[model samples]
Target: MRIIEPVEITPALAVMEAFLVQPSAEPLVVQVGQAFQVASLLTNVPEADHPVWLSTKSYAVGDVVMLEHRNYEALVANTNKNPAGVGADPPNWLDLGPTNRWRMFDDKIGTQTTNPESIELTIAPGRAVDSLAFFGLDAASIYVRVVDPYQGIVYESSVSPVSTDGINDWYDYFFTPVEVNEDFVLLGVPAGSYGSIEINIAKPGGTARVGALILGKAAVLGEALYGTSVGITDYSRKDRDDFGNVVIVERGYSKRAEFDVIVQTSQVSQVQRLLSKYRAKPLVWIGEASYQSTILYGYYKEFNLVISGPTASDCSISVEGLI
Candidate 1:
């Protein structure tokens, strides 16, 4: 949430000399909003009182650097006033200022439970991915776990801790990707553990500004030919050989200026029904050209049909006759 402005480097001898004067022997910690300079281009000036001209290099806008401060106890006391007293049930302390502070509790805290609604994912299959990436903002740490259908954990990542400073809105967290040889897989983690992905203005530190945790599946496109089409008049399976040969033929014509011609199985309706049950969208294509002449197509191959569309539509697709 801290907006840091960048500093321009200029060759000013007087300005450079003033910066070389160290504050104290104790190192000062450059925290979230603090600023400091690094030593660069040191030169010897024999005539000058301070013979060394230490070029000061400012910290980058979003750089998170640790300062070596010896007086940490004193600094913490000054910065974080009203330090909580020691003991399981310590006495209430009075706040002296409006500065934000945190207390270390002795009691063990319970891990928060996350609902399914708090999880988001991008599905990618067939890609060479060693890990998964999660993005969020203002989080102490992130925890990841893969669960099976029986509510059993398959894999889990160590609580990856990240500093909250310099992380403005959202950042990416990567985890090892899981391999799936089956039909389906479930991957999830608590939203808080992954940094809140919700968007809100009022809750600045409330992990609500984090956007959707994009669950991407690293996948590669296979040899499978997937597409949608329309405008078919007749489609049926033909005769069978000694072993029963199932031949399919489709015939249709488009009179519109723009029409699409698709060769699919007659079970397109069934495919659409299954997709609807899962609240998915069925793939459909629009006609692109006008065909006054009738076209006929045949397929002697075997394939499957997968209809993907909106849950409200009644349509299906046949994988056969498509290849």
Candidate 2:
């Protein structure tokens, strides 16, 4: 998503990744320049990012992925033994609701091989990926090789004989962190002269079903969309003059709105850092400002000046809306 900043500053693009976690847990979305405070993102370990759309991998219910330039959540997860060719939409994936971002393909092609399958993923041209996450079932082994654009094989390792038995038995395999400034990354059972692009997302030949393949660390704040202690910090209405006396025009809110928010948490830094990364993006606020709406979207605020004392609970945040 793109974020608009103040007239004095230029706009910035917010890079975000989507993922599926336990049904009970929330998925975290990363903002541009946010500190690596989350353990998953901070730890030099490979972890799941979001569910990967493995053309040949299988998925179950409640999984997530980005397909065809859209976010989708799986509902009734079922894989088609025979899937369509590349660039074709499979079957059975759905959006979260009448208005949602989750999606799934109706038909998923099964991996033809029972051995290691290779998947090659490419990072953005100038971007670097630090970690890799693997989620799946019934994989006997997972071998990872990270190659640089110029230098080959910067990092390599393999976990033989993964623990999970099958799709019914969900499990995950995380890799250690590595430097991936190169544009390409190769992952899967040992590529071993597969005659494929080594740096891109590579999957070894295998029948093992891959549920999710996140590239970065886990999002600790989850969505970072909700907050507490909200109140109308400022308000104004429109008025016009008609004839001799002034008359009130329709009471319209200003594009520039303000709100006082207090975030209560054991970790004040978490809330503070979240607000900082949230700068210059469209944010949703739910409270009196919403005015009969569950959420008031299209607000942008710069980094909040957090007031923290001895305890993690005492934290203050002021949100500045768009004008």
Pick the TM-score winner: 2
TM-scores, all candidates, are 0.17, 0.27
The per-residue C-alpha lDDT of model 1 at residue 11 equals 24
**Residue range 1-323, candidate 1, lDDT tens digits:** 00011111112211222123234523433234322333211122112211121124232222222211000111211222222334223322222221110000101011111222222211211121222332222233344444321234445554322322233443422333322111111123321111112111122233311211222222211112223332333334466678777765644321111112222334456433533442321111111101111111112122233434333222222211111
Q: Which window of 10 residues has the lowest lDDT sum in candidate 1?
A: 100-109
Against the hidden true structure, what lDDT does model 2 obtain?
A: 0.33
Cα lDDT, all candidates? 0.23, 0.33
Off by over 4 Å in 1: 1-131, 161-209, 220-323
* Whole-model alpha-carbon lDDT for candidate 1: 0.23
Using lDDT as the measure, the top candidate is: 2
